[model samples]
Target: MPDYSLLARQLKALLDTRDWLTNSAQTSAFLMQEIPDLNWAGFYLQRSSEQLTLGPFQGKPACNPIPFSKGVCGAAARTRQTQRIDDVHAVADHIACDSASESELVVPILDTNGALWGVLDLDSPRKARFSEADQAGIEALVEIFCQASDLD
Candidate 1:
């Protein structure tokens, strides 16, 4: 595992602003650059109660307007929980934005009041790419991100 402590500090430095738009872009880039085996790193904003719109990302083109009833991202958002899937292909509702992606980790982005802001999604071409430690670390990083931004 990469030094999440170090990465946290680095992300703190990189944010440099309270704007969610700017910070989201930077966070996506930071994760893609720092984490290994990642094919996609990005955000999916909860545009409505029913679906998510694509946000800043570093990877190939992605699927848009993901509903709360479908895919790993949807599961995370719907349950307000982190989702770590070992094999995305096994998921019947898995949205194949990138056929190369075999694994996924999604963390729900909620405010201090527990309002649904969005979700941070990471995709890897390798199966079982995200471990327990990775989920904890990335969740921590997402917490940091929410703290440093004005998500309202």
Candidate 2:
């Protein structure tokens, strides 16, 4: 189990006095350091109505400008929901930017007006790496980031 409360606190504190772009990099680094079994941690910004451009991230290189009709990241952004995929291979139209990624989690960032701002994406090499509790916790952390930064 992870200390979600402490993680949220740290994220909030980190974003309390920094620009979103600066904090975006820090958020990725923070999650990469704090979370276990994570191969990638990052963000995608809404560059258009149905397009997501890659933002700050940690891990190997990834796909840029993922369409809304594409993979897990697209699905999350399109539906404005969290897509916690336990197995990347089983999903249809799954984009394998990193062959080492076996599982993925994507959380869409919705602003105060309930509009899509972007997404927080995490990838892991192990199957079934993310749990519902992990999803809830990360959602909270992303919420803090969205609230504190210029991401909205």
Candidate 3:
């Protein structure tokens, strides 16, 4: 299990006064380095109510401009909730941005005003790589991220 408290503290300290781009880049790198069993870690900003444009990510090239009606990221955005899938292949609507990714966790990002912003997406090569604790931890980190940057 990862130490989310430490990660949260470190994330806050690292991104104290950075811009969105810098923070996004660092956040992806941070997740990639800090989290284990992760094949992909990144953010997808909501370009529109129905579109999610790919942001900073550490992994193979990803599918850009995903709609809010498709994939895990879309499901999270559409529902404004976290979508943690144990097996990507098992989900009929799963979009294979990376075929090697067996599991995925997507957390919808809500700005300080509680408006839908984007999502923090993580994928693993192992099935069921995430637990409920991970979902809570990642949600906390995303909260920190939202607090640090002003996303509109």
- In terms of lDDT, the best-performing candidate is 1
Candidate 1 residue runs with Cα over 4 Å from true position: none
Candidate numbers sorted by lDDT from highest down: 1, 3, 2
lDDT of each: 0.96, 0.91, 0.92
Q: Report the C-alpha lDDT of model 2 over 76-130, residue by residue, as the tens digit.
A: 9999989999999999999899999999999999877888988999999999999
- State the displacement of the C-alpha of residue 51, model 3, in Å, after optimal TM-score superposition: 0.9
Q: How many pairs of residues in model 1 come into backbone collision?
A: 0
Per-residue lDDT of model 1, residues 1-152, tens digit only: 88999999999999999999999999999999999999999999998886999999999999999999999999999999999999999999999999999999999998768889999999999999999999999999998899999999
The CA root-mean-square deviation of candidate 3, after full C-alpha superposition on the true structure, stands at 0.9
Displacement of residue 24 (Cα, Å) in model 1 is 0.3
Best candidate (score: TM-score): 1
Clashing pairs in 1: none
lDDT for model 1 comes to: 0.96
